[model samples]
Target: MPFINLKTLLRRESVGGALLVVAALVALIWANSPWAGGYEAFRSFTVILPVHAWAADGLLAIFFFVVGNELKQEFVRGELRHPRRAVLPIVASVCGAVVPALIFAVITFGHGDAAGGWGIPMATDIAFAVSVLAVVGRGLPPALRTFLLTLAIVDDLVAIMVIAVFYSAGLAWAPLLGAVAGLALFGWLQQGPMRRGPLRQGPLTRGPLRRGPLRRGPLRGLPQRQLPMKIVLVPLAVLVWTLMHESGIHATIAGVALGLLMRTSTLPGETISPSDRAEHLIRPWTTAVILPIFALTSAGVTVTGAGNLLASPAAIGILAGLIVGKIVGIFGGAWCTTRFTRAELHPDLTWPDIFGIAQLAGIGFTVSLLIAELSYPNDLGLLESAKAAVLLASGIAATLATVTLTLRAARHRRRAPDPAG
Candidate 1:
């Protein structure tokens, strides 16, 4: 099947990401304008659902769904399928998350309640990071893009674990039970005879199945057949949201778990036709619609007193951590691992080239912003300061990465031998 090429879609994400930056700027300007109050009101305006349950749950659940889809894809077909192939990126990502959290914890150590915000810098915004790589246009290799993406996915997984473990407030046994039941039901549906028909014949044939022509069955394309996966999963996801709201765990944790469950992939290294109908359906929805909306909603922030940002501790912590942490964690970790393990760097890339890509990894705007909001919703003043820091750090990192890589590319071009010679 001819599926939409991910490389092409990723290129489009670069363009969309530029638009998001512009939109964010417009939102900031409008929020601080004379009509600033109106901007706040608009953002705060509630979109009520028939089910009182969902309105209280907020948009974080949707965010988790997208996260789940991405995670599933990576595990199924992308970077994480082969443990050996995935090891270096995973190590770098873990270090990237851990060092920043440790830094934040140390800074906010004495303040018990405030220290909960330590998870704020743990996520990497793949869109912004990829966009920077696109601009850099040289020195960076395609493998670098894959490596960054893999690391970002790993970073997200760690962030989810942190949110689930540390950020949860109280435990409500009943609702938690309901969530478990939903997951079990969803699991049964996935493993049942319904999914076996096409999937058995489909390209993925590594675990307990063989490649062969699909068998026709009553389970073909029944939404009811697929119902348990989405139906129980989504509502239980809502239940998790409600439980978290009551339990004091961040509501977003529920979203991430549900997202992890939703993503799927084909078997390893199989050249499945891109034209597979399911892939066509899921890919566009995820890339274009779900991801962009999440970025738009999450990235808006009003930076009223920019000067305060320079002096704010939260601002300083976030900026320093992302700009310093990402580059150090990624290149440093990769370099150390390759040295010890003797793993080959992607053929076209050098240490300096990888360093430039590492700089791009500092583009943590979207995820950083979301985590900040979850970490500190009541403190708008602090939030604004943190947002400013994230923006500035990401911008500087992206600029450095882009300029250095482009120059390196130009130098390489100048030295290339002429075919006519």
Candidate 2:
């Protein structure tokens, strides 16, 4: 195969996903090697705060921020605009989350304190899933990818709610209120100084709305005065993150809150909305740096006893939840929704396609690792087993999905109609 250009490769979602994997592999190896002591020391070394916590609390928030923006756009002007197209993903996300938690609970039922990790496998890492799809999903129905994206976004919101309610420390009402106020201000600023032209008349309605989080030229359509507005937004955003952190909720929730409040529709002269620009500006950093750092710090598990970890309930629960539970949960949920409810799958797609996509949904790396940390804050041994289980399960999920989607793609191509007639 001919090599692609460096710039183009860097821009691909697969590249960032590859980096995250490589970082985790390096960390895992380092943690298990003879230099394990040094790895532990480095992970423990801090500058007035925990380095790993920064990756979890601060860096991951940037990823969630872009996700928040994507969710806003989809709900307002994208696939989520039509109620018919929206029903499947919404229902699937809820069922997908619930089933995994239930699986984890069943496995860890009698194990004291291990049940806290029931939330670890309840979420999907869309970044990894999308990359896997992009590489091997050629000739498949376009609806499959759309379904995955929509389902993941809604799934993220569900996961965020779980974290806020289950994982947070004692609530501090004053700071929580301050975070809410700051988010409101951020939303107000997103409105911009420009007024909306008549909705049904003119360029505002006719302009094509660009999608995706990491597109370049985000500032191309904005006015010069709007450039300086970042100064104010930056400080305000930090204030919100800080307040949310102090409020005993996860700080990443602040990013999601601010993202949801962004204005999705473009103003009179602008081609891009404030939400789009923010995503464009922040997505690259989140992908190239934040995710890799998070994987490095969180994925380092020193596997001293593989047999014991395999026997452990928390580990067994995570594996079962991601690999087995996700498949049964999401695919079963999709089937029941279309079968029982008025909702229908796209005419172009098949049940098998949904099954494959559900398999991909099990690659719950970044968020699962974070939840593992939160689930076993004081128990190093349990945390290690859980982290190992997550990595192993995600790899299995990715491999299975790849094989399933590749076969499906071949079948899709074979059935495609020719236009020569």
Candidate 3:
């Protein structure tokens, strides 16, 4: 019954995803309509600020700040904290990333300029994937959710590196230095005197302490907690954004790095859970605002003719890389790791279940779109084509995975002899 409330919000994510799908369709139709010019204008239309730099830089910086918060939450307490528990998904994520990139690189071999798009297929859009899991009914387990979340976080880390290393334009050392400085500042905030000060005061305690030595009270050994470090780190992250933008690296990378560095774990003895604090602060803004806006802006596409779709190499490469690469990499990596390490699969799941989940991992819409934007900022035609292919591939992958998993689970239930008999 307690989860009934949680289920409502979860259901809304799925519903919101459906709306996004509709919006993408509308954008496509509008782009191909007589009002095509209007569609283009909508994308290019800027919200101007009195300060040009703020308009150009500030909005995206907020986007990255949200990203930083998510990354911190994951590393501090989410999935990445326990290395053994994390190994399966981490391995799968690496394989998922490396194999898709290699596949994309091989396909786009001659087009050196477009090869930077290799990262396009490396990410798993957690929102979309979670939505699919929700739709796949009761076949999936909580452990699978944990597994996928961890895998996606690692995938994002890899994707961020790919953007920083491969997609960045001519590097300006100054901005890179500034980004590094920002990260250092975040790290210091996590471990330095500031974090310790709150912990020293002990865990939050209500009411006044009793007088005398007893005044130390029931909370005498209460661990200290840090003030929300984001107060300081946020401004610094914005500065990093400016520098990264100036240096020609995509500013989002700064957000990802700052997130990873600043999300230090509170020790078991600590009063407050750092991961809880970070997630509580970050998840809503990122989910509700940053990601959706990014989707709306980047997912716009025009599929005017079949010829345009067929001719676009980036589109073909991305779709194939995601649909094919994710299934192969996830299933193969999971199988190999389990066999070699003899690790136990989740009790309720089997090989078929793992394979089905792997198939769902192909839903790469969000990260794929982001990469498409970075890869083809000047080539709207290529970007649109890629967007279309990503949507189509993701649809097929989700459908097939959902159907297969549902049937498999049903069969599993049916085959078990009734214990009552």
- Best lDDT among the predictions, by candidate number: 2
Q: In candidate 3, which residue ranges exceed 4 Å CA deviation?
A: 1-26, 47-81, 105-120, 134-139, 195-230, 241-247, 258-274, 308-315, 342-349, 366-387, 404-421
What ranges in model 2 sit over 4 Å off?
Answer: 1-8, 138-142, 193-227, 377-381, 412-421
Off by over 4 Å in 1: 1-11, 49-80, 104-117, 131-140, 171-188, 195-278, 286-288, 342-349, 370-383, 404-421
Per-residue lDDT of candidate 1, residues 1-421 (tens digit): 1344653564354554555556556666776688887765666665553221232235535544454555556667765566655677778788888777677677666754456577777777765565456545643345566677667767876875676676645366676666666655554544433434444234344443343333466644422212223444456556656665555444555655655555352322223421132344444454455445444454555655467876666776777677787778778888888888855565555787777767777777766766776777788777777777777877788788888778767765676678899
TM-score of every model versus the real structure: 0.69, 0.81, 0.70
CA lDDT of every candidate: 0.61, 0.79, 0.65
Ranking of models by TM-score: 2, 3, 1
In the range 1-421, model 3's lDDT, one tens digit per residue, is 8665544453344454554455546765777789988767777776542222342235434544444555456556565455555577778888988888788888888875566677888877665676566555453555666677667667766876677677766578887887788777767766644533222243253333211121144555554443455577567766777777777665656655665665445543355545456555555454455444544554455554235656766667777788899888988887888889855556556777777778888888766766777888887667767777777777788888889767876776686679999
Error of 2 at 138 (Å): 4.2
lDDT, candidate 2, 1-421, per-residue tens: 2333544455556577778778878888999899988888887888766888787778877777877777778778776667766798779878898999999999999899888899999989876687688778889977787788778867776886788788866589999999999988888877764232222233433334322122225444332222345778889999999899888777877877777788888765467777888876676666678778877887787665355566789989999999988888899988899888888887788999999999999988878877888999998878878887888888899999999999999999999997775
Q: In model 3, what are the clashing residue pairs, if there are any?
A: 198-224, 198-225, 199-224, 199-225, 200-224, 202-222
Q: Which ten residues in a row are the worst by lDDT in model 3? A: 206-215
